[model samples]
Target: MRATIAPQDPADNSDWDVDGSPPDVVIKLSCPNAQPAPPSEEVESFTPAWTQGACDVLSTDLLSAPIQFSVIDVDALFDDPIVSVQYQVTRADIDRGVMEFTGSGALRSVAFQLTTYYAE
Candidate 1:
């Protein structure tokens, strides 16, 4: 039920920074039914290895709302998107527990897992 984000290279990925430095990276996951989830801890790296981020949606809500996954460069005044994608949850997705979807913009790889439970 943990998720990870690792940015790739400029030739293959994107240079999300503008100041000739590595971007201050954070992961964002949002859903229409809920307020935006809090941002993950900031890291300064062109290729950052971040894990167990702060973005997740309830299994029950997955079908009703789309989930947005974003990689952002956190700035003092504003944040810029590095890569973002909105995913529609399918019944198969919940059943599989792990999912991989196409990335938006310059990136090309994105995958994550979600844990689901049952209650009676």
Candidate 2:
């Protein structure tokens, strides 16, 4: 499955240059009763950015699982998460091709694509 994530305009962009430094972007995903996918790729020191990432999940029944996405900032030595959201996916949503969601408060909006087949 693939998820394209980024900060949603003003809320996420407003603090782009926090303390005169760019925010390091990180995305994470998890599913209940299944091994979590490796954290998504990170773009170091970015401001108001978007990222496309994919993970290979081995679960046989993804429809029953709720996938969670978390967006965070990687600081000098710690990770500060901006938003975290979870959705219980169905086969229909995956077939639909595109789905959108948002994080709490200042977390950015996220768009994701689901597919059972992968193209090399």
Candidate 3:
């Protein structure tokens, strides 16, 4: 699978150092039934992690098992949770071409664009 991630944090930049210093987001995935997905991505504020490829869903119960996306800030000294969201991927959505979704956490929201197949 391929996906894009974007930060929808509060627009107030007064407290943030806007000279290209924003929280670097680390994207991680987990499923109830297998080893975690590989090639976790990192994205900057408002910047999308574009079209990440080749995610294999190994669970037998693909519909019932949830796929979780965890967003973390890598710039922090310690582990910081920015957002955690989960959705069950169904075969119908996969065959429909592309999927778009959004999720909100305590600090901000995120927008995602997903595609299973790679194309020019």
Candidate 4:
């Protein structure tokens, strides 16, 4: 699934920079081999840790400004579910763009993962 940035946070926002320059970037998440059905409650609880790790990895790059991640789509195939998550990083959030992890079991398998996209 492909998720485009919302109009409210268009990719061309001039203000999306700390140094008055927009970073060329795009953020994407894919769960290709994920189980079709939701993971058990026990397994679901560990999602936060996984998200935290991803956030840490994303934040390490100084080029990319921190952006918040949001769920944009989810497709459940016969074997695995294709989850598409999106994030929008604004200039305003650059300074305060701390990585945050959030998920919902009801949506199935800790749906909705997000992080900021930065320039390479």
Candidate 5:
């Protein structure tokens, strides 16, 4: 999913970078039914991880709720959120083992892998 991003954080409209340069981005992947997975690292335009992909392995139980994805700028003092979106994965998605979704807020572009295994 993709949406345009400005230099400021959409969450609070704060500076995204401290040094007056572009922000290095990170991806936060989570599901409401489970604890958030580790933050995935990425570089400029958040392309490194997004172009390739970030992965989080989870159980089918976690799929009960919509998937959560957020983009954040990695700051030395603190990280700030740029965008967040929630997508409900349906049985069709599980059966296909892949799903296509969209962005809801402030996202420029994003791709993350939610790996799940289930019986047919």
Candidate 6:
């Protein structure tokens, strides 16, 4: 799995200076193989028990800031047990100077860990 970073606005170059100092950044995670398994009996009985896995962040270049993340989209592939997950990170989180990007895994048995970086 790979995480890609891109400016939200293509025409807005003010965020970056001549020295390559980016005022803000956004990080997105695109997992091609992520899916939720069948719920257990306990889950079925309770309030929709969703599988929880660990997404270990291996690395990041983002400065210490309060980063925000949200699930943007999910796509299920054909003839495969894997699904795709898209996560979005906003610039407001960067303004707070937060570092770590932590979240729970999607599937019941599957876990994910990703490394990311903040551009200069």
When sorted by TM-score, best at the front, the candidate numbers are: 1, 2, 5, 3, 4, 6
**Model 2: residues with Cα > 4 Å off, grouped in runs:** 1-17, 32-34, 44-53, 58-60, 117-120
lDDT at position 26, candidate 4:
26
Candidate 3: count of backbone clashes, pairs at least 3 residues apart or interchain: 1
Cα lDDT for residue 96, candidate 1 = 85
Compare candidates 2 and 4 on lDDT and give the better one: 2
Model 2, 51-81: lDDT tens digits are 4453444334556577787777676666666
Measured over all alpha carbons after superposition, the RMSD of each candidate to the real structure, in angstroms, is: 4.2, 5.2, 5.8, 16.3, 4.1, 17.8
Instruction: TM-score each candidate.
Output: 0.64, 0.63, 0.59, 0.26, 0.61, 0.20
Q: Write down the worst ten-residue block by lDDT for model 4.
A: 40-49
* Candidate 1 residue-wise lDDT, 1-100, digit = tens: 2223344334346445556566787777776556576767787865454565534556677777778878777777877666777888788988988776
Each model's lDDT comes to 0.63, 0.57, 0.52, 0.29, 0.60, 0.27
Q: List ranges where model 5 is wrong by over 4 Å.
A: 1-15, 18-20, 32-35, 50-59, 99-101
Residue-level lDDT tens digits of model 6 in 1-120: 122222221234332223343222111332222223222221111012223322223123222322223221111231111123343434443344332333233221212233343335
Q: Top model by TM-score, which number?
A: 1
Model 3 spans > 4 angstroms off? 1-20, 50-54, 58-60, 104-120
> Sorted by lDDT, highest first, which candidate order results?
1, 5, 2, 3, 4, 6
Candidate 4 Cα errors over 4 Å, as ranges: 1-43, 55-82, 99-120
**Candidate 3 residue-wise lDDT, 1-120, digit = tens:** 223333333343232333446666666766556556664566565444544522454324445677787766565456445667788777765666344454443344443343343223
lDDT of 5 by residue, 1-120 (tens): 222456556666665676566677776777655656666656755333443333444556656677877777777777666767777777766666556554544565554445675546
